[model samples]
Target: MLKRTISMTAAGAALVVAAVAGCGSNVQPIQVKLAAAEVLTQAARKTAQVTSYTVDAVVNVKHPQQGGGKMQGRMVYQSQPQLAADLTLDTVDMAGRSLPGGARAVLQGDTLYVKVSALQDLLGSSKPWIKVPLTEQGGSTEVRQLLDQIQRFDLGNMTQLVTASQDVKAVGTESVNGEDATHYSGTFPVDVAVQQLPADRQEQARKGLAEMEDVAFDIWVAADGLPRKLAMNGSKQGATLDATLLFKDFNKAVSIEAPPADQVGELPQSAPTN
Candidate 1:
C-alpha cells in the first residue's frame, strides 16, 4: 500500500511538470512599444539607402456630391545622376466615365512629358505627348504647381514623414507581398510634420499639407528592414482620399529615357482654363 501511494504521487508531480513545460513552449515574446519605434526608424533608414525603386499604387477618391474617381498607376524612381521617373497612370475614372486610355508621365532633366486621354481632344494634336519644362514660365501657374507637387512624391520624402510623426507605433507583424513584415501606424498633423523638415523643404511640405486635415499612415517593413507596403489616408474639404503603395525591386537598375523627340509635342500656347 505504501509503495503504491508513493508511485501515485510521483506520477502526479510528473504530469504537472509536463503541463508547465507545455505552457512555456507556447509563450510569445512581449513586444515593447519603444522597441517597435526603433524598428521603424531602422527600416526607414534602410529605405533611404536605396537609390532606386518601383512602386505600384492604387488610389481612391471620394467626394460629397461630384462623385469620385479611381486611379491605378506604377512609378519608377532613380536618384543617381539625376531625379527621373517613368510613370503610367494605367487607368482612371470619374463620375462612372472611364478615361479613354492610360495616361503616362516621364520626368527627365527638369522637364516633364505627359500624355493624357482627356487632353487629346483639347490639344487637337495627334502626337499626344505634351512636354513642359519644370519652370513657372513653361506652363500656367496651376499646371506648374501641379507638376511641382508630383515631383515631390518619392519614398525618401515619405520616410521623412514617418520619422517625424509623433504618433507612430507598432501594430504587429503581418504578411506583406508574401513576406513577413512588421506593421507600424501613425497619424500626423500637417503643420507638425512640416516643422520636422529641413528649412529648405518646410515651405514646400507646408504647401502640400495645407489642404489636408491630417494624414494617417500604415507601413509594413519586411525582415530585410525595407518597406514592403504603405497606406495613406487623408481628408480635405469633405472629400476622402486613400492610397496604397507596394514597393519592390529595391536598388534595381531601371532604364528610363526621354520619349523620342518626334513623339513628343509642346503644350499648347493657350493653356486650358479650369
Candidate 2:
C-alpha cells in the first residue's frame, strides 16, 4: 500500500512540473510592428504639435576602402524645422586620409554656414565661415545635397521610417539614456516603404530608395511612446552604411539663429574670367 502511495505522489509531482514547463513555453512577447507602429504614429503626431526640441546625434560613415569617419553633433529644431542642422564634425577621414581640424556647419533657412580648417587656404577671406545660399541657379550642388541629407535627421522622418517598415517586432527591453525602453527590430523594403507615404512624397521617397537594396532598423521606444534610440544599416553600390541616432529632451526649449552678418561671408564667385 505504501509503495502505491509513493508512486501516486511521484506521478502528481511529475504532472505539476510538466504544467509549469508548459506555461513557461507559452509566454509570448508583445507584437510590435503593427501595435508599435500605431503607438509611434500617435507619438509622431504629438511630436509635430510641439514647438521646439533639441537633437543629439552621433554619425559614423564607413567606406569600403578604409575605416570611414565619425561626426557628433546637436541641433535645435523649431516648428517643422525645414531641413536644417547645426553640428560639428569631431573627426573625419576619407580613404585613410585624416582631415585637419574638425569642421562646423550651421544650416538655417536657406543658408548654410560651413567652416573647415582644411579648406582655409583655398577660402582666402572666408577663413572663418563660408555662407552659401542654396540656389539652383549657381550654388554648390554638393553642399546643397549634403545639407539635404543632414536635414533628414528629424523625428518626423524617423517616425515615418518606422511606420513604413515591413517588419517591426519587439525583440526585448533595454535602458536607453537611463530610461527603460522597448527594443524593436525591423526591415524596410524600398518599394513597400514608398507605398506608405503620401502621394506627394511617394515619388521622391521612391527615387531616394531606388539605390539601396533594403534597410534594417532597430528602434528603442520609451514608455512615452517616443523613440529613444535608432540604428539603421543599409548597403548601396558595394558599400555599407551604419547610422545611429539618439533622441531625448523632447519638447525642450531650444533656440536656433543664423550667425551674425558681419561674421558670415558669401561664397566666392567663380573666377571673373573663366
Candidate 3:
C-alpha cells in the first residue's frame, strides 16, 4: 500500500456541508422514483424545529485517482429557529491519514480551536496548510467564510429549487450501523450544475448530454426524520462514495466557546497561509 491519503482539507476550507464533489461514480434512475422535490423542500422549511443535535458521520470517500476510505467526524448543529445552522465537524479522516488534525470547524456563531501542534499523532508533519488571504475585513478569513457558508445553508430556501427531478426512488429501509434508515433518490438539476462543481469543471461536465442529466443520490434519512445515511453515486451508475452519519451518540453537552481574543491570529496586514 502506498499509504494513500484522501483529504477533506478542501471541504474544510470550502465548508462543503451540502455534499462533496469531484468523486467519480456511476449513476442510474430508480423504480418508483417520486418527484418529491417539494417534500424535501417542505421538510427543510421545518428545520426550525430542529435546534440542537450531534452527528457522528462515517464518510466513505471514493475518487477516480484516490481509492477510498471511511472517514469519521462529529458535528454539532445548532440553530435559532429560522436562522441557519451553526455546524462543526471535529475530525475528518481517510485511509488512516487525518487532514486538518485537531481541527474545529465552526459555522456562524462562536468558533473553537484545537491546537493541531499540541494534538497527538493524529496528523503528519508535512500536511498542507490552507492559504487563505486575510484582509482588514473585520473577522478572521476562516471565521468570515465560515459564517457566510452557514448563512447560505438556507435549506428551506434551497429546497424550493428542487422543482423538477428524475430517477427518484425509495430504497425501502436499511440498517446504518444499528439505526434504521429510509432511503430516497433524486438527480441534480442542470440549473445547479455550477453549484455542485467548480466553474471550470462545470463547463467540462456540460459538454455532453451529462449536462442535462441530474446527479443521483440514495439519501437515507433516519426514522427520526433527520438525514442519517447518504449514498451519493457518481454520474455513470455505481456507488462512488458512501456516507453514514450516526445521529444516535449525539450529545448536547459538547461544549463550544469562542477562542480568546489573544489567541486569535491577527488579520494579516498580510499574513501567510499557515
Candidate 4:
C-alpha cells in the first residue's frame, strides 16, 4: 500500500501540474511578451537531447480528505545507455505525520533498493534496506512508480505542461542556478486544459478534477536554451498543490550502488501500506 499511497500522491501532483499547464505570479513580463510555449518547447527539446541530469525537486499537496504533505529531494537520472536513478526523500510528511527521518531509494538496472523506517518492523529485522526487483509496467520502469511516480514530473514531462497553455507569455529575465534565463508565465482555465488532453484522458481529468482550481505555472530557460527551472500550482475542492523543479548537470555521470546484501531484506508478500 505504500506504493499505492506514493502513486496517489504523485497522481495528485500530476493532476495539478497538468491541470494548471499555466504560469503567472511575482515574475513580471517584459516587452518581448512572446508566446511562452515557444520558449518552453525549445527548452524541452534541448533537455531531451541530454542523456542525464540532476534534479532538485519539491512537491506540496494539500487535500481535505486525503490531507497533504511536502515531498522534496535531489535525484540523479540517466536516460542513455540505460535508465537509473538515486534519490533521498528529505521529507514525506502528510496530515501532520511523517516517515521517521524520511526515506531514500535507489534504482539501478531492474532492481530497486528502498531504505525507510517502515521496513524495520515489517521485515522483522534491523536491516535498513529492502530490495525489490523491478519490471517494466506499461511504458515506464516500475521503479518510477515505486518512487512516487517520479517519471510523471521529471523535467521532460514537466515541460509538456506548457503545450496546454493558450496564453503563456515571456514574463521577463531571471537567474536560475546562476544562469541567466528567460521567464515564462501564464494561466489556463480548468476546462481548457482538460480539452487539450487526449480523448481517452479527458473524461478522467474532468471527473477527477471536477472541483479543482486553475493552475499557474512558471518556467525559466537559460541562455543556452535549456530549462533552468519549472513550477506549477493549483488547488482542488479539498487539496492544493505546488511543485517546482530545478535542473542542472545535464548528462553527468551518476554512480549508485545497492546496499550490502546482509544489510538488506527481500520484500515480504505483504508490504506495509501505511
Q: Across residues 1-274, which tens digit of lDDT does each residue of candidate 2 receive?
A: 2222212222221111110110001112233455756765655554444444555555445556655645454544554445444555555444455446656667676777876654444555654777777754675555654544443323554466567775677788899989888888888876676566556555544433323568788888776666677777777666565656676656554565677888777665562211
lDDT string for model 3 (1-274, tens) is 1111112332342323433211101212222233355345433344334455555555555544544544455555555432223234455554345655435543333432333332212333232222123233543444444444444442222232232345556657788767776666776665564445335444433321123345455565554444444443333333254444344322233344444445434222332223
Pairs with backbone N, CA or C atoms under 3 Å apart (clashes), candidate 1: none
Model 3, residue 73: displacement in angstroms? Answer: 1.9
Give the true-structure RMSD of model 2.
20.4
Candidate number with greatest lDDT: 1
TM-score of 2: 0.72
In order, the Cα lDDT scores of the candidates are 0.61, 0.54, 0.40, 0.60
- Clash pairs (backbone) in predicted model 3: 25-234, 26-236, 26-237, 26-238, 27-236, 27-237, 33-168, 188-215
Backbone clashes per model, in order? Answer: 0, 0, 8, 8
Q: Per-residue error at 2 for model 1, in Å? A: 99
Instruction: Give the clash count for model 1.
Output: 0
Q: What is the alpha-carbon lDDT for the whole of candidate 4?
A: 0.60
| Model 4: CA > 4 A from native | 1-35, 136-144, 151-153, 189-213, 271-274
- How does residue 75 of candidate 2 score in lDDT? 49
Better of 2 and 4 by TM-score: 4
lDDT of 4 by residue, 48-91 (tens): 46667777778787778767777776777665465667777677
In angstroms, give how far residue 40 of model 4 lies from its true place: 1.6
Better of 1 and 3 by lDDT: 1
Q: How close is every model to the real structure, measured as TM-score?
A: 0.76, 0.72, 0.54, 0.76
